[model samples]
Target: MEEVYEFLKNAKTWYLATVDEEGNPQVRPFGAQNIFEGKLYIQTGLKKKVAKQMLSHPRIAITGMYQGKWIRLNADAIYDARIEAQQSMLDANPGLKHMYQAGDGNTAVFYLKNAVAEICSFTEAPEIIRF
Candidate 1:
């Protein structure tokens, strides 16, 4: 879990994939990430299409490249309605405060559950991490 978090945090920008109602895949670049209470959390606006897609389909994939290695993660995105979760994310990413506030109703935070991440590089065998 720590390795996965480090990879993502260092990557700065990771892509999140979710399935829409039509069953098509939607991919978007995301930069907000944090770990709270041993859970990896991501932030987005509740009004965004990505949030809607995630709500309808909790299963998702995320990938990011850092240095010469990349990480692919599959997990269930469980929405956390608690203000503390939202606030924690906002605190981690202070820039987000300009666009969202805790309990603002538009802020949405989700903790990844049952996550399996593979860190791969052409020069080495893949390293797997599960949390």
Candidate 2:
């Protein structure tokens, strides 16, 4: 889990894939990531389409590339309604404070649960890490 977090941090940006209401795939770049209470958390605005899609479909896949290596993470993105989770995400990403604050009605945070993360490269075999 820690490795996944570190890789994502180093990659700086990850593409998150979610399904729309029509069963179409939607992918977007996301930069905010946080780990709280052993869970990997991501932040977004509740008003965003991604948030609505995620709410309807909890399953998501995230992929990022860094230094000739890449990672693909698949999980059930469970919404954590706790204010502490929101606060943790805000604390991890202070820049987001300008756009979102803890307990704000528009702030949404989801944590990856029952995840399977794979790190891969052309030169090396894929490494599977599950949490």
Global lDDT of model 2: 0.94
Q: Which stretches of candidate 2 lie over 4 Å from their true place?
A: none
lDDT: which candidate is best? 1
Tens-place lDDT per residue, model 2, 1-131, is 99999999899999999999999999999999999999899989999999999999999999999999999999999988789999999999999999998888888999999899999999999999998
Q: Write the per-residue lDDT of candidate 1 for residues 1-131, one digit (tens) a residue.
A: 87888899899999999999999999999999999999999999999999999999999999999999999999999999999999999999999999999999999999999999999999999999999
| CA lDDT of every candidate | 0.96, 0.94
Poorly placed runs, candidate 1 (over 4 Å)? none
